[model samples]
Target chain A: MKTCYINGTGCISTQNTFETDFLSEVTINNTENVIYANQPSYKEFIAPAASRRMAKGVKMGIAASSKALKDANLTMPEAIIIGTGMGCVEDSEKFLKSILDNKEEFLTPTSFIQSTHNTVGGQIALGLQCKGYNFTYVNGAVSFETALLDAKMQIENDEVESILVGGIDETGTYTLSLHKLINLVKSEEDKPYSVLNSNSKGIVHSEGAGFFVLENEKKESSYALVEAVSLQSSLETEEVSDFIANFLEANNLKISDIDAIVLGNNGDVEFDDYYDISNSLFKNTPQVYYKHLSGEYNTASAFGFWIAANIIKNQDIPEVVSMNALKKEAYSTILLYNQYRGKDHSLIVLKKC
Target chain B: MEALKQELKGKIIEVLNLEDIAVEEINDNDALFGDGLGLDSIDALELIVLLDKDYGIKLTDPKAGKTIFQSVETMATYITDNRTK
Candidate 1:
């Protein structure tokens, strides 16, 4: 089986991650319960005529994919696959509200046309004029990881040498209001959110798009060799330590072998313990987390993946991302573990090239 | 005619969520698609809704919008001609 390598990556998030030297001017958002992406100059990445029909999610996906392709020095990929949890919610909300508010009297097809979950992936393929394999997964939190796994399978089977994969989510107005009503949003009293804190009941909801170009060949910009990636639908907090141990062991790795461990801790009191258990297991290792910067979403784990890829490429862990003060002498092998709402557990192991 | 054109631009901006754009930015003779205002297939749909919702015009085929929505002037003319309400 051929090893898969991430050649290029692009992110559009609450931060200005699309512009050149974007990471230099990072803002740590602590107040807002719902944050939207600091958008890119879509006109640069997309033609105005083509962008008119794209929903925010589709626009974000296309821009991110275009940036990824440019970074990877590739024009088009052999396949396009994407993962989105609440796909095209803005368009969906528009359509549904129009039906209710107008009594279905004279509805048009814009929202309904763009509301499909696969629209982003379909739009990307159409923009690239790529007719190869296309797929979109809507399995909540595991959506992006499922896309990665499918891309890996294709690479191993030699079905495609290069693939464009992404995870994207966009904030919708009424749906976000519904989330707020359910206390999915942090209450006013829940100000100054901290991911490691134990007092929180829910996360600070945010949205972003992260895209990567995965190829069979290792290049100069290859972040890391994708050692292995595994996903589980359910697991108890107690099972997490052993889960990591077995996952590492299966890959012929030990806890001590992991130079740095990147975790996904969304600050929810109920579910953050999953990270706590795994943190205890790798407490001595160089530990890091990024949801505070990326914020929490179904596909926010993609941000963590982006962080892991950068750490492996730069061979230096960003001090801003460290959950603990412990530092590693040489950042080599990294393990990224993330789960959402006590489900969709994922383990991604990466090794420096 | 001028009122209808301004109304059409307003509805288009509102329905499309052109947060960065203003009504005055759209000229009546500006091409609604392509290089004029840079709208695409999706914006066409949103404008299609604007026709139905505001002017009581229902166009079943999106292709019919090509000529009808070429410009604000064209859209206003079509709505004036075919509006049911």
Candidate 2:
């Protein structure tokens, strides 16, 4: 079986991830219930005419995918797979508003055309002029993991030598208000929000895009190997430990085999117990968490994936993301577990190349 | 006529999202597609919607767009003759 290696990664998050080194310029924002992505200028990667019609999500996808492809030194990939929970939602909001404002008459097509969930994947494929396999997964929190698993399986099966896989989501004003109404976003009373051990019930919502170039052969720029990925649609807080352990066992690993654990603790007081449950299992292992910097979104775990890959490649953990004082001499095998609102649980294992 | 032409330029710029091009840069006779403005078929659709929504002018014959949208000058003239709003 062929091995799938993560050779390049590009992430645009609430932190300065696209321009800065791996977690070099990181800040913890606790004042706002909704955080926006720290977007880099797209003039270098996208033309003005092309980008004028694109929503923030599509632009982020293009910029991140460009950086990933460039980092991999690849001009074209055999496949482009993307995952987005709320794809081009800004455009969706605009189109919907237009329908109401115009009474569904004389509606323009630009926003409507760009509002689909597959726009990111289609736009990336159009930009690359790559007519290969292009697919977008939109399964809520497990979206990115589903795309990652698809790419890994294709690489293992020798169906494709290289693939560009990514997860992208963007915020919209109306959507944020809706999420806030449902108490999915932390209330203003819960300001000074922190991901770990927080007294809040809702997450600090945000948006971002993370892209990776996966290939069959390990190269000099290879970060880590895609060892395994497992997803569960629903699991009780108590079942998380066994879910993780069974995943590790299927991959011939144990809790001790994990050099570090990246936990998705978004400070949602109700759902974070899922991580706490796993925390008890890997108490002694070096722990890492990133929602404090990236904020909580459906594809926020893609940022976690980027962090885990960097840890394995650089063999160094940023002090900002460290969850525990426990340290490892070298991070060889890293496990990433993420879920949203106690559902769509995912476990991904990455190993040193 | 000049005011209408200027208004057409502003509307085109706003509707097409031509951020880099100012109204003054777009000559009255400059082509809206192909070599001049570099707009594609998608932009063409936007222009059609703009004409219908703003001027209340519906170009039922799609072939008329090729001549009417040849330039801002042509679009302004067409609107001048056919505008209901």
Judged by lDDT, which candidate is best? 2
RMSD to the true structure for each prediction, in A, is: 2.9, 1.1
Please state the error at residue A56 of candidate 2 in Å. Answer: 1.1
- lDDT (Cα, tens digit) per residue for candidate 2, span A1-353: 99999999999999999999999888889898888999899999898989999889999999999999999999999999998888889999999999999899878889999999999999999998999999999999999999999999999999999999999999999999999999999999997888887987999999999999999999999999999999999999888888988898999998889999999999989988898854589999999999999998999999999999999998998899999998899999999999998789999999998
Pick the TM-score winner: 2
Each model's C-alpha lDDT? 0.86, 0.93
Per-candidate TM-scores read 0.90, 0.98
Task: Please report how far candidate 2 places residue B4 from its true position, in Å.
Answer: 2.2
Model 2, position B23: C-alpha lDDT score: 92
DockQ of each: 0.46, 0.80
Tens digits of per-residue lDDT, candidate 1, A1-353, equal 89899999998988777884536667787787777888887988776646665778999999999988888899989999998889999899988998899997657677788899999999899888999999999988988899989998898788999999999999899988888899877777888877777487888899999999999999877888778899999999889988888888899998889999989998888888898754477879888888888888889988888889888888787777878888877888999999988999999988888
